[model samples]
Target: MVRFSYEGSSERNLKMIITFDLVNTSNSDGRTSLQDESRSGRPNTANNDWNTARVDELIKVDRRVKRKEISLKLDILKTNIYESVYDKLGYRKVSARWVPKMSDEHKRQRVEISQILLHRCQQEGDETVE
Candidate 1:
């Protein structure tokens, strides 16, 4: 056992010693470690596949839907609902409302349309657009 001390620790002067579990932990694959084992992180209690699909469908129906509204309607925590929309469903707020990330095809079409407008402006001048 080895005593480890931190002079600047603010946790009410907490101190500890090296334990056998940390020094000789043989993981199932036969690895010893002093670090925490891998974990799946926070549980996806509400932001699982089902909620993700629901969030997608809801956004499709109403782009102006708020996170709080989704939380109330789906009875899910706001944080989890937010994760489903932003992280899983790939949505971001634009003009105070969520907008789905554009697909590659949609982006290409937008670029093509912008190019056409640019060409028209060069030929006809900016005043002619209005």
Candidate 2:
């Protein structure tokens, strides 16, 4: 029973020491420390480079592959597959299809094409257009 004096220790540090002591005594395992113990099982396997690459390859093979299908095929979670596709590979859903997120260049091209079509339509007049 160590005596913690207010003159020697700050309130916060004393509280922390007492909390640590309580935790150490209450711990079922003999190893009572602040460090994280080595965990078993699959870890963050789905978020690794290998899994990201695998998900990317699957998307390349089939743009319309559902997250559920990818999870089943890769033996990973649907949320993980979605994160890999959207966060890692930069893809998004458009019209029920997975497509690469549009870049500035692609957006400009789309706008240009639309403007050209509009100009042509005006020249021909609404009645002549169709």
The prediction achieving the highest TM-score against the true structure is 1
Give residue 87's lDDT in candidate 2 (0 to 100).
Answer: 89
Best by lDDT: 2
TM for candidate 1 is 0.59
lDDT, candidates in the order shown:
0.81, 0.82
**Model 1 worst lDDT window (10 residues):** 16-25
- Per-model TM-score versus the true fold: 0.59, 0.56
For each of the candidates, give the backbone clash count. 0, 0
| TM-score for candidate 2 | 0.56
- Where does candidate 1 stray beyond 4 Å? 1-43
Put down candidate 2 lDDT per residue, 1-130, tens digits, no spaces: 2445343366555542331355655475676576877998877877999999999998889988899999999999998988899988899988877899988999999999999989888888886567
In model 1, pairs of residues that clash are none
lDDT of 1: 0.81
